[model samples]
Target: MRRVLALAACASATVYFEETFDSGIGERWQTSEWKDPMGAWVWTSGEWYTNEAKAKGMQASEDMRFHAISAKLDAPASTVDKELVVQFTVKHEKKDYAFCGGGYIKLLPGEVDPKAFGGDTPYAIMFGPDLCGYDISRIHVIFENKGENLLKSDEIKLDYSDKDEFTHLYTLHLKPDGSYEVFFDQKSKASGKLEDDWAFPSKEIKDPAISKPSDWVDTKRIPDPAAVKPEGYDDIPAEIPDPEAEQPEDWDAEEDGEWEPPMIDNPDYKGEWKAPMIDNPDYKGEWVHPMIPNADYAPDTYAKYPDLTTLGFELWTVNAGSIFDNILVTDDKAYADKMAADTWAIIKEGEKEAKDAWKKANKDDDDDDDADVDDDEEEEEEEELKDEL
Candidate 1:
């Protein structure tokens, strides 16, 4: 154990891993065999124009299905530290802006076959955003403890509405105290205890033998027994003839059956009789399930991943147009925060400005094209008149 601690201390002293994709994916990154004939991983200077600058990034899919890519750290790092931090940025720029793709990454352990990586491949941690149709649009933070992969039990609602079409930064931090924090664009979004958030069976559960008494009055209100229906209430008809409606002066009684007044909804008619309700004096409060020590439940001491080796991105996308960049994995919170501030903060503001400029340029081009079409139409009409003359 002494030697192990010494080795881990040496490994954690230096920067664990980082990627910026400025010069394109080099020899370190490897991609899986293309599942579809048209599927591809594209490296572009910028997917969209934002002010005058373009975002140079890597896109994992090409509007195709079953796309997968992985970037294994040249020097695999250990996650067996007092704290672990992971951060990355993603941009979804699909033409229609409605796409089903993964913005998350997977951190793998031990040696992994980069050529054959897929969804079933086991990973130490999986964190990022995922969207599918209308229902699934959330950031997923899953941790592999023991032999089981446990997902956070709480639903994380991400902002993926139609108007949301910009780059977003995601960060995850795991502490030795068995707590975790999730951040979006440097803002703390969610945090909780690992044991409480994950789908681990509770150490304490509701007592099966305990139940509320049969006579317990849970209803808050009760019908008044003394309240009675008013006199002649039932005599009021649901409909009555309109006395104000005038009949035609022509004697059409024999031609059109009997001259009867048209029936209309009666103003005085009440639909039904019901007793008034009042607060019940015997009403009891809400019943809470009594919990006791679960005989089958056993607490888990969160294990450290001292052998964490590889990190990768394995995904399946339907309308692929997600750009991933600026990946960082380390045990240093200060380093992670600094990287976010230096990279994301600078690029985010520029990206927004470039996006607006691009929209204006495209609109102007469209307007010019429309004017040329109108001029051609006028020339064609003049030519037809000359030929007639």
Candidate 2:
């Protein structure tokens, strides 16, 4: 929590879009009916209290429905040769229901109707935290190219450290060098060249005119041909009758069945012998497909979006009440970092105290029971507020 207001004077960065949702949110943002019946989006501090009104965010106010909302940027953001940074914060207030939901946002390119933005709307990039069931937890970093949304081949796994109800930041930094980095709560989580983790076109491809030799021996090991099994090894039985069994003196032979010894594993029984494995003398190394210069190979220019005009969220959450705030899209990493410090870092401690106070005020008198509202009841209370459009 640097709480750094010192870096506010820097003007080298270009901020295409920024919002704290402190006030005037609905005037700049719009909702979509992409799902016909969509979840409600509210601007509040949720059930908990916050000392700073800026901490109040865009919350998915309902449960078990889709939510799509977007806002036009002050100007179109272009990633021609400069670094692009997308950062936002989220809080999953429902502890038990945080497992199945999404808190990610997207950057749209070209003309987009903010009111009509939905899952089908084309976007340049998407970045944020997402959890579905116990197995799927990750900070999604997806980019759209050639009409397909490309996901990282190697996933970004999320764990207990990143999953919490407290406010936390998610950031994605994409550079012009085909490199990118992902951060969680201001700490680096993953970084690599885009092509290494994405489905970018390769510079070369396997030659279609050539193949590995048919006689190539790829086996690394083989059984020893000279090894022989010992004579009469199969004579030993796997099991034998118990040698210590004895009949009780009071047992009645006429009324009861004859006593039988329990079978046991034979101590001296030898198992079937196997030849020792050795390195294959004639084996060639594993065949690698011959590669050639592919005519289809091209530099990944799709990474750059020249006309990105909107920033928004379009996701489905089984459990709502996740808050999103401090949305930022900038051309400088230093600027975004400073903004984060001045906002989330400074207000986090006070927010925590306020949240605790609110919880205490709402605690049950019995003490043994939790006062939190039941999620199922809330789900039933939530219904689509149909759009007039």
Candidate 3:
């Protein structure tokens, strides 16, 4: 019989890993650390081995390379409404690589299949430092909730440049819906919507008690952890919900004078822009973004027509040189045209009505003025007469 552990509702699920069974290095934990340090990313690889027989799980291997720990957790498939927080510490000896160590949580169906490792359909959360400087190897979250099945990728950069003694906290808040809200430390960084139709299994149970992979080895029948109330954890009250959760208020022109493109909502243009392709013969490399006086049109504004420089211009991806006159530049004219016309279209429509209203109000004020007895008007009329003289 397999021993099971039940998770409390709307609370932190704490499981202790005994150091005697498998330690961090001895467990051979897998991560993105196997590739060339210079290449894109390396996947760290290892397995968990336990000494206890009854306390063991269904998925244990003997590739010893970790610190001793007994209980290793497999995240529940659909823990929506549950904030899954993982706190751990990493010690680095070298500060040269800066982005030397990084890891990602594989929130998917099975052990990452090489065939689906970098495929467009996988789910993951990444954390680490970048090689380049300025103290920034923060955590980044990636998913494929939208876009081409292959290009389903997104990132959230964190600030973890100081590799000194630090306790890292990664929180995955499962929304009421199947989507997710990821936070580094306590700061919420990114939120993504999960498609309603995507097939997400509720649980994956691997019984460490069974050894033989025979036809009778039931992979589907994972015994649920018996219902036991969690102890030692503070039943803390929930914080008040933030209505504008991830929105940056200062990005608005009326609120903040600084330039921030991704924070703009309901922009003037509503057309999708694409990068320059071979389809257009006049495809010169003229997708440069122009400078703006107001800088309000800095991000998300397209470049000149056919110069769709803003093709991949996401809020998180726009840069300094890319923002032209408060507009994001593109490499294609069609994209630029759509952005310029759409944005100005809103202002133009409003301006026409505002101008007409202003003219009508001025005429009414002039007609209703106390023309025969107003000293202020008489003084203005005398001044006009003096100027004429």
Candidate 4:
């Protein structure tokens, strides 16, 4: 043991371990205080410690005061099956059982708030000195969700000395192939493979396969390995037919196809709306019409029309069959009433007005003709006077 200690110390002296805090500002280490029948202690922040020379500087307070708690390192989340090394030292504060146990190291999910959280799915490695004769050590892990305790708290009796306040190391090893072994003082204490060597209590249990025994001991009862069914029973049924398969029997003919064009049932649609040839009932513009009937005559022939070259207005098929220049109106009341009375009446009225304007213009043209005739008559009179002279 002396040579072993020296070798361990030398190996540890070669390597260094350190703790890193990645939390942001105002969020450093936090501790929780709790008191129960087991006693009172504070839970601190998660830390990583390794057996190295640097750990000498990182040692817990050597002062004869409060006992420093040890972290679980990497314990099993399901069955304490993972390899883990728990390290802690005992102290003599008042010399009267100052430190109780080394406390416990729990494998927690990386930083989650408990109040906002619901389930307690953490795994742990726990060891507290027993008030009874021997010191107790346990790799406590849980596989079930929201459970309060480990699935198989198989308390393994650790072979250790009791009198002195010494530092002890417990290494729990779990192989990649699902085999587990526990080592105390650098020596293997237990060994067993997972599914084959040990069996679970039930095939459908949430607890892992670690809840089995390697071989039956004299005192303990090693029950028969849990039963496992054949491969296909694990999955859902694959042969069931779909209820929504496409079929004429399930189809509703009345609801199918293009909604029957809402036109057949609606009475408001009077087949065709013969556009009234009169001013629109909704028209609020000046009403104008052409003197000559031209199907191609545009309403804006008399007024300034929009620049069709710059505007994209060619999309419309002009219904240019109406006889009128565009009617301009400030109110729709007269136009709507007149249009409703007789579609052709509005155009007749505009035609009358155009004829009157034309008659007046022709009368002016006749007056102009007479003025030219008078000039010729005046010249003839001048010539007669000249001859008489």
Structural similarity to truth (TM-score) of each candidate: 0.70, 0.81, 0.29, 0.29
Instruction: Kindly list the per-residue Cα lDDT of model 3 for residues 236-263, writing each as its tens digit.
Output: 2233334355646445766666543343
Q: Candidate 2 or 4, higher lDDT?
A: 2
lDDT of each: 0.71, 0.79, 0.29, 0.28
Clashes of 3: 68
Separately for all candidates shown, the number of backbone clashes (residues 3 or more apart, or on different chains) is 4, 0, 68, 10
**lDDT (Cα, 0-100) at 112 in candidate 2:** 88
Colliding pairs, model 4: 72-105, 285-328, 285-329, 286-327, 286-328, 286-329, 287-327, 287-328, 288-327, 299-326
How far is each candidate from the true structure, as Cα RMSD in Å? 9.6, 7.4, 37.3, 52.5
> Best by TM-score, which number?
2
TM-score-superior candidate, 1 or 4: 1
Query: Which digits, one per residue and each the tens of the lDDT, describe model 1 over residues 73-180?
Result: 545566554577888888776623235677788888888888878778888889998776445678888878767998878867675342245778899888877788
Q: Please tell me which predicted candidate would have the highest lDDT against the true structure.
A: 2
- The lDDT of model 2 is 0.79
Off by over 4 Å in 4: 1-28, 33-99, 114-148, 151-153, 160-163, 194-200, 203-389
Error (Å) of candidate 3 at residue 266 is: 50
